[model samples]
Target chain A: MTKPAFIAVDWGTSSFRLWLIGEDGNILAERRSGEGMTTAAQAGFANILQAHLDAISAPLDLPVIVCGMAGARQGWVEAGYIDTPTSLAAILTGAVVVPGQSRDVRILPGLAQRAKDAPDVMRGEETQLLGAIAADAKGEQIVCMPGTHSKWVRVVDGRVTGFSTFMTGELFDVITKHSILSHAVAGAADMPADTTAFEAALKAAFEKPQLVTNLMFTARSGQLLHGTTAAGAQALISGTLIGAEIAGALSSAGQGAAITLVASGRLQTLYEEAFRSLSLPYQTIDADAAVRRGLSAAAEAIWLKNESKS
Target chain B: MTKPAFIAVDWGTSSFRLWLIGEDGNILAERRSGEGMTTAAQAGFANILQAHLDAISAPLDLPVIVCGMAGARQGWVEAGYIDTPTSLAAILTGAVVVPGQSRDVRILPGLAQRAKDAPDVMRGEETQLLGAIAADAKGEQIVCMPGTHSKWVRVVDGRVTGFSTFMTGELFDVITKHSILSHAVAGAADMPADTTAFEAALKAAFEKPQLVTNLMFTARSGQLLHGTTAAGAQALISGTLIGAEIAGALSSAGQGAAITLVASGRLQTLYEEAFRSLSLPYQTIDADAAVRRGLSAAAEAIWLKNESKS
Candidate 1:
């Protein structure tokens, strides 16, 4: 068995994932939990990390590299942000070292676009970008990372030019839970997704992105007038949001820009289906793999190569 | 004072407004309360309506005309709907008489567009439309009624063509109260609105309606990057929603269609500003007066004129 060399952690707002990398550059062990920054902020970030390290029986002196909300102001440590238009490699140099730790710990900084009109910031996803694209890649590339707050980033010749965050997933959650659409989506979770309703809504919203809110109202109106099922309503809401997001994201892209979709599981299936339905071409990248590779790059740049040189 | 002729009630989801109309068509007495459909459903609709009637010293035999949510399926009575592509007078004839009442009480029916692609329904707003536009008015007319659920109706040659309901106001409310943007607008209510931010957001959204959710994220990113105030964030959210709504509403409007804005109070000011910012020509009408006039028309059609004729 390959000996564990370092730890890679993606500590988000509500989720935590840890991977122990061996000397041979392979995942020796992995752990996932709900002990993200929010939970760890209350439970103690050090204690949580220590417990996971203890469970994995990792080397006491092993260096740990972390990314995501753990570096946010309210998280474990403020790793700060690297302003655009910056090369993806700038993220490696912006890692903030944890103070007074027995084992070396570093957290990657986020990316901030300071444009007055389109001000935007993203944490964790920057690392995913690092792994998803090659440093020497050519042409304009649009990377879509779908999640609670879906991000659409524009990269020109390996440097991130700009990006926009669409509140798709979070909006879906709130609209179906707190808004009038809640009644329309009740009993939807227990049912299978209605693909036909989803694709139709996706096409409609993509064509008339301005009518997003009106399209959302159709979730209830359709149920009332067309007798659409709860599952259909849920699919409509999801598709409308995603469809509008895709339209907005692609609006600023350069003509013939390649699309790289970084997602996994349900989100993967949904976005791939949306791309097909809309006839938009895109390449897929495993989100977990991308983030892990990003952490690996940061790890080697910060510690591994430096240790060998010393 | 002229003798009281009839009672007009506009019972909405969360508000109740009643006006005692005299024989001369002037308001003799008025009562406003929070006993709208939701509250009335729990506290007894008939009892609530009778209490308001008693407060105004209304005669027992005096007839009543109702509009708004009170005519919904879950309200006082199911007043049903007048399908679209019909004369505005159809709404007047579709009034449903409430049974088991000593006094003659009728609830005006709503308007429903049964288009499979864009099914929509409007209760009180239809009555507002009845008063805002003349039945025999020629050409195309677009009515903008901004509220919790903003409604936009397209009318032509005295017939109601189609309408759409945008969940703009409701989306703003939920996004600000329940989503991440909630933190961006924490203390906005106590502060004056930021018109600069509002106008900028309005134009941005109007130009790129598809980028709405992405623009919404600027409410937070602006604060983080530019130190934008809570008021500014709130204004941005409002402007984005309203701007997108206007863009969507106008997308389907016919060329040379006159815009009739039916709104009052804060909504009136906001929408008026939105229209002016976009340089969109619109004539304003008092929403209260419009709904009242509509209720009066319904009363005259159902009982007042009929009583004299009999």
Candidate 2:
């Protein structure tokens, strides 16, 4: 029986995530904090890490692997991203080793893809794709990870081929909060299970794709004339946003790409319903389950990689 | 002949404007400054007003009639707006008089519709619209005034029937600065003459009208796939923004209510082309001309109202 040898971190804009795992891929403990990259930007990285690290009374020598914004320009270490159409294997295999004062910490570099056909940059998803392939181990798999920036990652033979990112969450915030659509949305309400608006909007999206801008006036106009409330307006906005997301994801991956959507909560149902309606074959995986699983797997791989050298 | 008994001020978010007119409606002098409401917010209203007045060597004893945010709760004085379908006869007739030290200052109220129906509000436009109506005096007409918050004013029989405001400028800023669409947009390029992209986007807007949200994703997808650079992307963003503005204006005014577009400089061609393509009849009045006429008209109304009292 081996003690936990390493921790994996998924540091995002709003939250800091930690996963502890043994050499034999098993989760030992986990921690989280509001001290994410954004907060850490204000509170300095060293203090945040020290405060968060206090959660574990272990040897400070434990090797740790960090992902996400923790590797970007403002993150803990600036591990530059590699460009698009990159593989997880390439990322994990090529991840820059970030040395911490008290421990051996490795921060992964995000990919920056600029090609004739595709131009995009991605970070953090590469490690997860590596872990997902390590777990799924099937043939070519397209992983659709949804968040502020939704990524459609292509993995072939445990290697990341390429991926595209849509600034879905950011756009959702802008359109809903600032655009004419704000009049349409209220505070978050439970999405209708059937997602009637989502389906209609998606259908509308594919049919008359240009309505994106024109339909905006209706958010306010409907209320002005037709007496549409803000809540109903919000639904229409959500539907429109999801519709755009679906159209972009479908076009990026193209038809026949079996999409395994790693999602949960409200977005899960919306994406599930939207993908199902598109006649696209997809499997809905609990995002949280995959998150820890992916984290632990990366930890185990890193531990082994270091162990072999030792 | 009443030498201009007062100066009328139309202060907005980005620009400060003032006009001095004789009792006979002759434009005596006019002044312009970048120190508008938002900028003025930092400088303290008294300083902004005094500085501008100081620049023109305007008489402190001359009373000033002001419209727009300068009268909001955050402004120099909270001159409350009158409800509409209410007329300028009512607003002008119902103007609130603020007694200042040396000179009497009055800030005219903007028009507020059901905050729910359109959540639209306007300030300077009420005075400007009155001027447009004063210029024509044919009584009731629709004045389409375009700015960050585009207004379509209902002038019924020499009085303001009602008006609605749309957040076009703010929407343009958010889309270009924050939204995924920003990837495609140029940094504040002047609207090209008969900008093909702008025209096409406007057509796309009115074409489906309902699927507007779906269309936004293409701003990113287009750039990603077809090498749509920032300028072309910006054109699309502008197209979408203006298209939405046009849609909002059209919807508020309903189909074909005679409209006189109050604008000048760069906005003239865009508005003229948009209205023409939509088959919505409109005539353009120079922006400065309208502002001058509006200031003169407001002054005349104030003088008349005061004389009636005296």
Candidate 3:
């Protein structure tokens, strides 16, 4: 018998993506849409999955696996988290065979949080961590994902341990785009990549973080009295946010540790430079591809379960 | 001659408001518009003033005094700030008579900050201090204005002694409205007043100021696990912010002295209660009223200067 195709899904708050992969983990066809968890919550998750299924001509009996927020309380079915110090085997989201669909459907549970200092609640990333673990055949590793809220997870012997979340991206946006520093820059943000300005700002912020407020005055002060360009001010503020993030993250994570950063966006260059400046050994992983690979890994696990049941 | 009608303008970065004052300082007419300094900059100060003049049928020549950001360097003109420990008379923006117009124009200089811990800046509020001081007419006082940024100032001998700014209101808004608190709460925060929730949060924050991050968890956990409503969680966050403000301002300013709060606006009720609970004696000042009077004071200063010059 020809190997049956395995279906995979990686969904988030704003977007939904799906993939059909062969036994060798090769994606035959892929599709994405705006029907994410947020909209799905409004229309019901069952309907969202149907829309995706209608797009594929494959048999409904094919084994399917899902990751991301789809297993959140608001998702199709709550995939209960297995908690920290847990492995993939232990972090199972009980399989739910969607009624009327011949194929088995299993959704990965999200990780819920009640951390001491952080404000965010996450669900899908743990499954991705599971995928990361599955990606590597051996050895302990730490997965660092940078974005609006940066997350770092430690994996030892296939068991997920402690994790930390930082509001680095959001704070950077606020300080440069919304807060008082708006006056210090000549023009609005999204100006362009300014290496010189970025470096100047980073050095100042790292040297004396308190000067942030003081530096804000220079935006208007220079334009008003000393004549500094708005673009220069923008760079200054951006630099400060990045610099402060380095200063803050370094203090917590400490120095001289290897880090594997999962970043695949406009911020790739900036974060790469930041890691280099800190003199830390690190590697960058494609975020989109990782999510896709994670979905496939989850699907593979579901296939094993189905084989066992039969 | 009969006393001339007066105009008091309190213009800032994001808003412009003015009051038409009768000879006796009664508010005959008041108007506010979105054309704050930040937006009105393109029209030039003279054009903005003309727009206000067009709003009123009364003579354009009625003595006009301006305060707040309108007097900053990028403002119509840098009504150079009066140094600390200086009188209103000492820091007057030299009398400028509007050419081709039959009236007097006196710009009140905003206070320039020079704290070792903060950079120097101030505007229209300095004139309000002049009016606030004039209203008090007794001795010394402290003014606390809470918003995205909270300001605490010490007024002595009719001049600002020193002041500091705290990112409380804006920070609170960011955390509750834009940050993680948004998810924990059923909806966005515009948390109504709940005295018990407010007081409990106040007490907790006051007792353990450094546990701010630890305290944030309650915004979500209290609701999911402990039965606190999202609004209640939001209120607790607000309480913590104000509590942090009180703690920060006190420590920054140092204690062992009596304080009279220039209390008004949204801060009046909670701060009054906060002061009472802590046994700090303070008298409330009407903020909106103070601005009108401040405009009048600036006008009065301008008139006196002309008379002395003649």
Candidate 4:
């Protein structure tokens, strides 16, 4: 068995994932839990990491490389941010080392766009972008990483020109759970996916992105007037948000730019369906794989190569 | 004191307002309460209406003209809807008489636009529109009724053409109360209004309505990165929603059409500021007065003349 070389952690706001990478650059074991920054902050980040490592029976001195919200101001450590326009490789140099740790621990910094009119910031997604896009990739590309805060990134010749964060997923959660539409989508979770309703709503919102908020009302009004199903209403909300996001993202994107969607599971299927329904071409990249690859790149750049040199 | 002629009530989802009108068309007495349709439905709509009537010492035989959600399916009586492309005067003919009441109680029907692409229904706003626009008025007019569900009605030559409902107010409420932006807008209600932030967000959203959801994220990101005040974040959310609403509302409006804003108090001030910031010329009408006028019109049409004839 290949000996574990280092641990890679993606500690987000509400989720934690750790991969035990071997010397042969393969994942020997992995651990996933709800011990993200939010939980870890309360439970102790060190204790949580130690418990996960202990569960995997990892070597005590295994060096750890981390990404995501764990490096945020409120996270395990303040790794800070590298402001755009910056090359993807620049993220490697911005890693903040955890002082006083027995083993080597480094957290990757986030990316910030300081444009006054369109001020934006992203954490963890930078590493995903690094792994999703090749260092020497040519031309402009729009990479969509859909989640709680879906990010649309514009990469030009391996450098991130800019990006926008659409509060699509979070808004959907709040609106469906807390807004009046909550009644419209009751029992929607137990229903089957309404692809037809989703595609229709997607097309409508994409065509008239301005009418998004208005379109959302249809989830309820449609149910009242036309007897649209709970699943249909849920799909309508999801599609409308995703559709508007895609439209807004592409509005600022250069013409003929390639679309690469970095997502997995349900989000991947939904976005792929949305793109297909709208006849927009896109390539898919598994989000987990992308983040893993990104953390691997950071690990190799920061520690592995140095050991070889020594 | 002049003799009480009738009672006019605006029964909404969460509010109830009744005005005792005199023979000379003046308000003889008024009562307001939180026992709207929701409460009335549970507490007995007839009993609630009777209690309010008894408090005002209203004539036992005094007829009642009701509008808003009282006419909804779940309210006192199911006052159905009048399909659109109809005249504003047509709403008066659609009043549904409540059965088994000692006094004549009639609930006005709402307006429904059954356009498959943009299906919409308004119970209370139709009455507001009835009082805001005259029956014989000429030219195209856009009526903006800002509230929990802001309605933008397009009236062409005194006939109700179509309308759209933007979830602006409700979205603002939920996003601020339930989303990540909640922290950014904490204590904003006590802070002074941020007109500068409001205007900037308004203009940004109006220019790019598609980017509204993205712009909403700025409420949090701006606070974190730019040290924006809580009031500024609150203003940003308000401006973004209202701006997108106005943009969407006007997108379907005819060229050279005038905007008639029907709102009162805080909503009026906020919407007026939004319109002024965007430099959109608009005329204002008191929402309370408009609804009262509409209920008066309904009373005059349904019972006043009938009593004299009897």
lDDT against the true structure, per candidate, is: 0.92, 0.66, 0.63, 0.91
Q: For model 4, report the TM-score of its A chain.
A: 0.98
TM-score (chain B) of candidate 1:
0.97
Worst 10 residues of 2 chain B by lDDT: B208-217
Error of 2 at A49 (Å): 7.4
- Note the residue pairs that clash in candidate 3: A184-A219, A185-A230, A186-A230, A222-A227, B67-B124, B68-B124, B113-B120, B113-B121, B148-B170
Tens digits of per-residue lDDT for model 2, A1-310 = 6587677788877888887766566767778888888898888876776666677764588877787888877687888766555545556555567665588777777776555324566667666565555644657777888877778777666656666665667767887877646645654455433355457656654443334433344455555445665665665555555665666556555666678888879788778877777677888777766766655555556567556421
Q: What ranges in model 2 sit over 4 Å off?
A: A13-16, A31-64, A70-119, A126-288, A296-310, B13-15, B33-63, B82-90, B100-105, B115-117, B131-168, B171-261, B264-284, B302-310
Alpha carbon deviation, residue A118, candidate 4 (Å) = 0.9
TM per candidate comes to 0.98, 0.62, 0.72, 0.97
Per residue, candidate 2 scores C-alpha lDDT tens digits across B32-56 of 8888887888887777777767776
Using TM-score as the measure, name the better of candidate 3 and candidate 4: 4
Sorted on TM-score, best first, the list reads 1, 4, 3, 2
| Colliding pairs, model 1 | none
Give the 10-residue window scoring lowest on summed lDDT in candidate 4 chain A: A301-310
Docking class of 1: high
Deviation (Å) of B46 in candidate 3:
8.6
- True C-alpha contacts between chains kept, each model in order: 0.94, 0.11, 0.02, 0.74
Per-candidate DockQ values are: 0.92, 0.11, 0.15, 0.83
Model 1 per-residue lDDT tens digits across residues B1-310: 5888899999999999999998888999999998889999999989999999988789999999999999998898999989998888889898988999999999998988899999998999989998898888998899999999999999888788999999998999999999999999999999998999999999999999999999999999999889999999999999999999989888977536878999999999999998899888899999999999888888887776657621
How high is the lDDT of residue B41 in model 4?
89
What's chain A's TM-score in each predicted model? 0.98, 0.87, 0.78, 0.98
Q: Which ten residues in a row have the lowest lDDT in candidate 4 chain B?
A: B301-310
Residue A50 alpha-carbon offset, candidate 3, angstroms: 5.8
